[model samples]
Target: MYSLKKELLKKHYKGDNKSVEYIFNRLTDYCGKPVRYNMSEEEPDYKWDFYNSLFFVITVVSTIGYGNLAPTTSFTRIFMIFYALIGIPINGIIMVTLGEYFGKSF
Candidate 1:
């Protein structure tokens, strides 16, 4: 088990041997462990369903965080970075528009 882990660390890891552990831990901290996510298979599409996607977007835009619904893939993670950057301002505009609409109505 240990050898396999070490072998994987060596195979995928690009850093110098002395800093492999440090790089692994640092990268894992933000990116999370893909192996663990793969092991615990939940829904076939975690955010594909309408409500699930809505919930995910709400959390991301509101800066409430994903909680347990973390992005596992590198592409999804990178996409989410852009998603949040754009979504937050869009959401803010929607909220302000609604507030003005309701205020005028009252």
Candidate 2:
């Protein structure tokens, strides 16, 4: 299993040193082994992180529009509009509840 994994990694990397190192580091991290490479060389990809997703959802629901990560395609834009239409009221209720709770606490 270990040799197969190593072979697959080598084939996937195809001799690109940077990609090899990146995959090696990720594998090591997943396996709880000590990482041998400095992780700062690569910029982190946050396309699906929690904060980005929450920000996107909040912007859509609040009608505040998008920032740098807005949808670029027509289909996605249409979907987002429908989603906002459905979600805005729900989000409003949530915000109002939170606001009231905080107001009472303070």
Candidate 3:
């Protein structure tokens, strides 16, 4: 029972700020003490849902060039211009590094 409580406590504290707050709340019920921690939600400037971001990053690095959904604004377009200049060579280097690592591992 103690192990289970400890595990639950550990699990609760393992995520970001909101998660720590939740864990602290649950801990209060167990410990019979009023815990206080003011936690604020972290809202990302450009929120990329995990799965979508994964797909987008994979597509970018893999050089698949799927043009279905792309940048659609002046600012984003301009950013992409700079990104293309710096990113392409960096991405190529990363791909080469990964390939070498894979080759060695295999």
Candidate 4:
């Protein structure tokens, strides 16, 4: 990939030796940096398993929305709209009920 890109860059910038060299260096820098950083890459595990999926739905229902999570497919996005509409109100009711119970107890 680097060699092919370099060859294309050389042809594209045929007479401009200075700009070609500068861009070549930048390209190689990008190619090298990924190796050093790959270890820190995050796993896409959210909403993949049952427990995490439950937490993701809870986050949505409770309105702490989008903690770096989102539904990507068209159907999922549409479903989430209806889910949140129904869920948020139910969650609010549950929260108010819990608060009233605790308020009387305390």
Candidate 5:
């Protein structure tokens, strides 16, 4: 699941919608592992629907971190180094491209 999210973040940073959807659908297939909620109960708290997760990931990739969620362990922190290495510049390029697109569109 972590790898899946990493791939999605990378694809999103690169502005690849098809790759993003591919990872997202894969999440649907592997639903049991990487359980979204925190607890084992009749109804777990903070059930993240697809779009919510997407939004969370976008926030993470774009570095607009609201701090409501975060990576907890050293391993994840290490992986985040790699994630940011690729994601930061990709995100910047995408932002610039979108700004140009919108500027031309307007």
Candidate 6:
């Protein structure tokens, strides 16, 4: 049981880390920035600013679907479809495994 739990945690962190890296890379590639950080730059505000984009990614992987912010461009939208396809399940598994571990401990 301990070994199984350890494996689950290992897989979860690995996948989650990859997902986060992908989100950050995508945001940077798309020039997303936080709302507050926008003042420092002379560029137009994007729909998926850094903070909002991070929130968006978290909401997506966690299946929250807040519907507040979203990808505007077709490319980004398409990319998100694929991203979610892979990320959501990994995150769900992680949450469930962690919950089970804690529940068992308690």
Instruction: Evaluate residue 76 in candidate 1 and report its C-alpha lDDT on the 0 to 100 scale.
Output: 95
Tell me the tens digit of each residue's lDDT in model 2 across 6-96.
6657677776787877777677778775544443434335577898889888888888875646776999989988898889989889999
What shift in Å separates residue 62 of candidate 2 from its native position after superposition? Answer: 2.6
TM-score, candidate number 1: 0.53
Considering only N, C-alpha and C atoms within 3 Å, which residue pairs clash in candidate 3?
Answer: none
Model 2: how far residue 98 lies from native, Å: 2.4
TM-score of each: 0.53, 0.45, 0.43, 0.58, 0.48, 0.52
Whole-model lDDT values for every prediction: 0.72, 0.74, 0.66, 0.74, 0.68, 0.68
In angstroms, give how far residue 7 of model 4 lies from its true place: 22
Q: What is the lDDT of residue 6 in candidate 5?
A: 67
The list of candidate 2 runs beyond 4 A from truth reads 1-46, 104-106
For residue 9, give model 5's deviation from the true position in Å: 45
> Which digits, one per residue and each the tens of the lDDT, describe model 5 over residues 1-106?
5565665567564566665565566666677443332223343345477977777678778989876556669998788778878887899999999999999999
Span of 10 residues, lowest total lDDT, candidate 3: 36-45
Query: Compared with the true structure, what per-residue lDDT tens digits does model 4 show for residues 1-106?
Result: 5455656565666667676666656666867632221223454455478877888899999999756678889999999999999999999999999999999999
Model 6 lDDT per residue over 1-106, tens place: 3343344445554556665455445445555533221213344556656887788889999888987667779998999999999999999899899999999999
The regions of model 3 sitting more than 4 angstroms off are: 1-48
lDDT of candidate 3 over 1-106, digit per residue (tens):
3454456657666668777677767767877755445333332245568976666656655567575446669998788667666767788999899999999999
Ranking by lDDT: 2, 4, 1, 6, 5, 3
Model 5 misplaced regions, further than 4 Å? 1-49
> What's the lDDT for residue 97 in model 4?
100
Q: Give residue 57's error in model 2 in angstroms.
A: 1.5
Q: After superposition, how far is residue 84 of candidate 6 from its true place, in Å?
A: 0.5
Lowest lDDT 10-residue stretch of candidate 1: 34-43
TM-score, prediction 6: 0.52
After best superposition, candidate 4 residue 56: deviation in angstroms? 0.5
Worst 10 residues of 2 by lDDT: 35-44
Q: Pick the candidate with the highest TM-score.
A: 4
